[model samples]
Target: MKKIIFILSFLFGFTSLYSQKLSSNNSKAIKNFNEAIKLYENYNYLDAINKFKKAINIDPLFIEAYILTAQVYSDLNMFDSSIVYYKKTVEIDQDFFPNAYMFIAKFSYMTGKYEEAVKYQELYYNHYKLNPTQRARAKIDLNIYYDALELYKNPVPFKPINLGPNINSIYSEYSPALTIDDSTIIFTRKVPVKDKAMEQEDFYQSKKLPNGNWELAMPLLGELNTPNNEGAHTISADGKILYFTACNRSDGQGSCDIYRSYKIGNTWTKAENVKELNSVSWDSQPTLSADGKTIYFASARNGNMDIYVAHMQKNAKWSHPQPLPDNINTARSELTPFIHPDGKTLFFASDGHGGMGGYDIFYTKKINDTLWTTPQNIGYPINTHKDDAFLFVNASGKYAFFASEIENGYGAYDIYMFEFPKNIITTPVTYFKGIVVDIDDNKPIIHAIAELFSLKDASIAGKAITDIDGSFLLPLPAGEIYALNISAKNYLFYSEHIELIEAYDSLDPFVKYIYLRPIKKDQIMVLNNILFDFDQATLKPESYVELEKLYNFLVDNPNLVIEIGGHTDSIGTKDYNLILSEKRAKAVYDYLISRNINPQRLRYKGYGDTMPIADNSTEEGRKLNRRTEIKILYNN
Candidate 1:
């Protein structure tokens, strides 16, 4: 309405300057034009349009009448008709209203006439003398038209498959979030309230069957789904924690604010407002990283909606939210930011970055802590004339899920799945899924911390905590070797090296059953992540991460005495293997002592091939046999 008022006032200002010349010579045409203006002011747009057309019929060259009719059609969202009348005014006198060319270009683009839009936009830019701000905006529009034309000519492969009736209905369903494994999907469903004109939004979830079909979706259980609106959510990689948007509740700080909930067993806990993220203005559409340590969401605290980010603090509270750089957010609304499991690529929706029309989906890469790459439109068709948002890419980077109101859909906005072009994804990702258990009774070990470290820089890649069932998932980014360390209180830590340097697929993930032995006398555990050069005892630099973990374990258990044991495979002579193993054991013993583990409490031993855990006939068995082990000699 504001835009319409502005357009009407601007047109009136221009026409008033040439009222004598632009007006029709026929008094009947002038009378109809005045009556049309009165009808438009009364909000009778259809009647006003008819009156403007009557004025145009009375005097075929009445430029003001033609302009008014086009404006009315535009307000009615009849862009094709709007373009026709605007073009008629142009045919009469193109110089009468220079801004008319701009409108025609915009309407053409909105109606998907890309080439025509580009032509009129170029004429508008070349003929008009615009101020700096106006010129910049016009340039942006021109670029958008060109880009839309290019993409329209070369479309990406996009076939959106609906999630089906089990997860969708006659009601609108959108804002879909998926677990890392793609085993579950949670989305917002807009359902009509009983006997009311208003609709209510609630969270719904569906689990995938072994046959790869989704089970019937049901409203999330527990106090999480209240009568108040709940929508636009994100689930943790493991699907145990949920961060979502809720509005008009007693606990809200704004009309709409972000809320968080936890799933325990089969029920979700009551949602609590994320006060740190909420403001007096609207804040919503939260997305969590794979590690659940960072969040990206949209907020209108500074007026127009922009993407904001906050990191989870050590105290478990979120840090103060900060908006993304201007390169990503503009003077217009930006919403529904989804950070991929890779922790770098971010997909969002923005109107500020000009594209086809309305909001278009864009993606950017996080270059560093303070910088991000410029956002790029994902392309046409995937991003149409209508608003396109809420893109959720699965961990594999192979497919994405979004909502659309398309032909044959079961709902107004049904969740749809589409594959991503491999070229568009900057980095692929996979998850490390496994269970941790006690070695003695084989019982699940809850609250064990699983941390992944990039072997290149030894920086932390991702982390996860074992659930009640001892299940955990850690995101492993592509193109790196990672060392995984799992530790729990009162238990020996476990370590293993995961190689993902080659192309990795999410469908084939790294799965393991970790057995954590209780710290006790004579308990021996292999330090699987410890590395050395062939036939050399000197520790490689890659061994430091695991070595640090081992050092921490010894420091935490100061009263225990341990022996470092090194074993050899059956490929070498017993005499040579014994000497080599002894030297390797001594090397670990010396390193631990140098790190302040009391030498008096440490011992070194060579097991050679005498204590092979696996048959040393194959390479896998031989690799398992040649290992470094830590055995508790005495526990006080």
Candidate 2:
């Protein structure tokens, strides 16, 4: 079988297996064999095949000629034909070639003959003495055959849809990345140059139109893509940072090093080589987390290509990389890692752990933020007896994209997307994203920070800073209520709690167009995220984060004094509502006083149900009415 990424000399090169065994008792066969060997040495595979066939026709029992013919076929990548010829040699005399059994077992498994492949493997093991490496390989092969047989018996749905011509080209395209909203997609495409013999890999981008169709893809504009190759990249969730592979560059610390770029206004800055991430060995295929704090990549450092993860520290320096657990890496190689935005399900291609065939895609979920669970094969049709790598699961967990080099694709390799079954999905993710604009002129506020917190625990779940266009995106899981806070330098902070119910396949994204009012006197803003105990003066623990924002605001603008107004819904008597609202306002007032603010600058009021913003008719209206608000009292 072909090793997918790198070339292994032992798998492709010939072993000197005593070439004089059948050097013919007949002079005719002897001449043909000598000529065939000469042609094979010159790399003339077609003519060598003919010469080997001539010798086989003369002496049908010539085991040496049969072995040479099979080697030529394997070199040509006609693996089925090679297997047939190898089997013919073994059938003539079971002990004719000792390595024939192993080669036949390998090719048979590649062709999906699992039972026969296992049979041949066991036969080779029992009849011949084994070396340490070869014996371990045989054991792995046996396990792989059983896995193939088991998965083939009960196949999952793997009907992949070809991403149409708008994304794919007459050349090759692969390694897809997308933001949480799925509006833009970035991938690597290799197109032929006008006069160059070799095709260079370049990044391309496409956006989904309002009509829900992808636009024509074009080359990505950045200094990252030059005459040299740049590919195998991952885009952060906000679509502002990019991490990719660049080889043989002047600034590279190794043969291939990982590089990163920051997007500044629809244009990317010059890439910088991540010096701490690279070593003296080949390193590439980077997958960065949504928050850009964690990264995983494939490296050939510990004598084999294995997956290693590195973490970015609070000081903005990356720590040393550590290899993944033994369950994921093997004596063989693993490559093409895709860590889902949810940060738990990791999909990667591997040949080390036993699977159906070459580099099958497997996924494992993270237990906590710590160790990962054991790897499991995705399924049969999704993972065939061929190389499958570079899989991407969109944030919604609806579909996946990967590259395949098959006869039916556009060219040497093409990107294909498959809609996963509901059960096969990664963790469900919902998004809340849009542009933050100035209410005065509707211009984007480019420096806004958005924070999301779990309503249950009052702990922050995620956060994002707006990009150049004042656009922010945050990924959240379903079945939870999250409180959000958006703030800027001179604007009133926006606060609200969003609810997302759990549903596996159907997710509706929340698109918010936030308009912020500038800091001015008499401007009233509701702190919707603040909470209080029922019918009591005590502030709930969840109100601390929001109150801290208010305290900080007071400290920043010392001349500004404000009134904390409390209101209630029309659910109780007028006297009860009035008392409850007063106590709640004082609860906030005392908390601020304890924080050492000037007490003379603060005042409290209870509007009760008199200043209701909504009708208080439905439950949703009642939710809106029960809120704490702040108004600018004096600016002097």
TM-score for candidate 1, please give it: 0.93
Best by TM-score: 1
lDDT of each: 0.87, 0.82
Model 1 scores a C-alpha lDDT of 0.87
Q: Tens digit of lDDT per residue, candidate 2, span 445-490?
A: 9979898887788766677888877889887777677788898988
Clashing pairs in 1: none
The C-alpha RMSD in Å for every predicted model, in order, reads 2.7, 4.4
Please give, for residues 1-636, the per-residue lDDT of candidate 1 as tens digits: 444456566975543332345458899998898788888878899999999989999999999899989988998999999999999988998888867889999999887889999999998887755667877878888998998888788888899999899999999999899888888899999998899889899999999999999999999998899877888899998898999988778888999989999987778999888898899989998999987788999999998899999998889899999999999989988998999998889999998888878889999999987799999889878988788889999988899999888999996889999998777675677888999999889999999999988889887777888989998988777889989999999898988878887877688888889999998988888888788889888988888888889898888888889889999999889988988899988888888888988888889999888899998989999998989999988988
Clashing pairs in 2: none
Residue 393's lDDT in candidate 2: 88
Candidate 2 error regions (>4 Å): 1-54, 95-99, 122-139, 406-410, 455-460, 467-469, 504-507
Candidate 2 — worst ten consecutive residues by lDDT sum? 1-10
